[model samples]
Target: MEIKAIITGCTGMVGEGVLHECLQHPDVKEILVINRKPCGITHPKLKEIIHNNFYDLLPVATQLHGYNAGYFCLGVSSVGMKEDAYAHVTYDLTMEVANTLAALNPEMTFCYVSGSGTDSTGRGRSMWARVKGKTENGLLKLPFRAVFMFRPAYMHPTKGMQHTQKYYKTLSWMYPFFRKFFPQYVSTLAELGQAMINVTIYGYPKKVLEVKDIVAAAAITGK
Candidate 1:
């Protein structure tokens, strides 16, 4: 089967990593990227759509209708954002995309890049965690054929750096040491991306997948 996908946050580290893997997969026929700025990469199977705001999706909703999968990686750090601003990014923006996509392609598989320690309970004291939890819950409510919430911790990436990437870089350097002792809490960006693609291509047994599960799945898929 040829898989058609839509990827948001294509310029981000994890997003770029996943995009690379998508291009390498024989099953993938096309990848549509929606972002605020250009990714500057060109490929016959790739389409880049630039938009200033996510709300602009309303006008192009039809173009997003036929994708087989959606990898939603767009997110922001909650450290500096006000509560409303953080919620807008974590919950509002996510729900907007998921709802729109669900309406357009009810059969699409949706995968989200979520973090560990996310409080699925809406009443959690941690604001960001709660917002992410709410977003995850709301996305699950949508009528997609498959919906998965991926919770990864200390993701080790081979390239790219943002403020958080530096921290992960430190972890990546020490991964060999940690893997020998505590292998449960860490996962590579390659594994994370591959695991997500596998879940979308195959079928995930659960709605939420933790770090250990993701690593195991990635290994089985030889990714």
Candidate 2:
């Protein structure tokens, strides 16, 4: 199945990596990126939108149509943020955008970038985990054709990408060791991006993907 995907968070590490793959993949014919600012990249298949507020996408709703897939990578860290503030960005904003997308394209395949320790039960002790879990649960209730939650732990940065996180670059050499010893928790950005595409094209048995599932999906060439 060919893909016309709507991607968010192109300025961040994961989003940038996914956008890179989408632009190069033959199966992906068109790409749309919605961000507050320009991502400073150009491609024949790419279209960008600069919308400051994601809390409401009504202003850009007309621009988003005929997209069968969505890659939601927009997120913020909870390290120093209060619960309300974190939820506003992580949960509230995401849901608002997702709800609009669901209404616009019910058949779209939705992929969310959730961390490794998300609690599906939403009863976990960690604040961020619980919030993420709640978000995941809410997303599953939507009417999209398929919904997938990716739980990646240690991600190796993709080379030649401008938005690769500095911390990831610092530990790039250790990825080989992590891949050899703790394979379950380690994955490359390339694999994660490809895995999402594969899952969207060819539905997987499991909806939630760990590192191993992601790697296996990336290996699949045909839908």
Candidate 3:
């Protein structure tokens, strides 16, 4: 199946990496990104819409039609963040956009880039994990074709990508060690993107995918 996907958070590391893969692949025929600012990349298959308010997508709802998939890569750090503030950005904001999309495109398969150790029960000790868990559960309740939650531990961003975040320099160096010692926790950005595309196109058994499952889906199938 040809993928015409709407990608969020393209200005960030994970989203940028995923957008790069989508542009390079043959199966992903089109991409639309809604960003607060320009993502600074271009392709014939790509079109971008700049909008600051993710909470209110009604203004751009017309442009969101005809897409078969959504890659929700937008996220913020919870360090030193309070519960209410974190929930507003992480949970409420995500739901605002997701609810609109699910209604507009009922057939759209939504893939969310959540981190590993996310709490499914919403009772985890970690604040961030609990919030992420709530977001995952909320999306599952949406009336879309499917909602696949991706729980990657640590990602090695694509080498030389201009948007690769500064903090990742520290993590990039540890990628090799993590891959060797803790293979399940380490996955490349490229694999994460491919796995998302594969799951949306052909579908997967699990609603929530971990690092190993993400790696396994990276391989493209002819049939």
Candidate 4:
């Protein structure tokens, strides 16, 4: 089947990586990326919408319709942030956009970029984990055809992507070591991107995919 996707957070590392993979994949026929700022990419299969407000989707919700897949990679760090503030962006903001997309595209296979240590119980001691847990649980309740929660740890950034975080570069030298010793905790950005695309097309046994599952899923296409 041809894939038409709505991607968010293209200005960030994860989103950019997924967008790059989608542009290269033959099955991906159309892509609509909604970002707060320009992602500075152009392709025949890609369309970009620059919108500042995610809280209210009334403005651009119409443009969001008809997509069969949603790659929701937008997220914020919780460093020095209070629980309520982190929840506002992590849980509240994500749910708002997700709900809008669910209403617009009921058959959409939604992929959410969650962290490795996320707590699905929503009662975890960590603030960020709890918020993410709530968000994940909430998304499962929505009426989308399929919703996959991706929990990747120490993602090795794809080469030549400019939006990579500075700290990832510093820690990249450890990726090979991690891949050999603790493989389950690491996956490449390419694998992460391919995993999302593959799961959308071929479905998976589990709804929540950890690093190991991500690697296995990515290998399916062999691109």
RMSD of each: 2.2, 0.9, 1.1, 1.3
- Candidate 2 positional error at 130, Å: 0.7
lDDT to native, each model: 0.83, 0.92, 0.93, 0.93
Model 2 lDDT, residue 207, Cα: 86
Q: List model 3 lDDT by residue over 55-88, tens digit each.
A: 9999999999999999999999999999999999
User: How many clashes show up in model 1?
Assistant: 0
1-223: candidate 2 lDDT, tens digit per residue = 8999999999999999999899989999999999999999999999999999999899999999899999999988899988788888899999999999999999999999999999888777898998898899889899999999988889999889998888899999999999999999999999999999999998888888888888988898773
The whole-model C-alpha lDDT of candidate 2 against the native structure comes to 0.92
Ranking by TM-score: 2, 4, 3, 1
Indicate whether candidate 1 or candidate 2 has the larger TM-score.
Answer: 2
Give lDDT for model 4.
0.93
Error of 4 at 181 (Å): 0.2
RMSD of 1: 2.2
Q: State, as a TM-score between 0 and 1, how close model 4 is to the true structure.
A: 0.97
Off by over 4 Å in 4: none
Candidate 2, run of 10 with poorest lDDT: 214-223
Model 1 lDDT, full chain set: 0.83
Question: Deviation in angstroms for 20 in model 3?
Answer: 0.5
Error of 2 at 36 (Å): 0.4
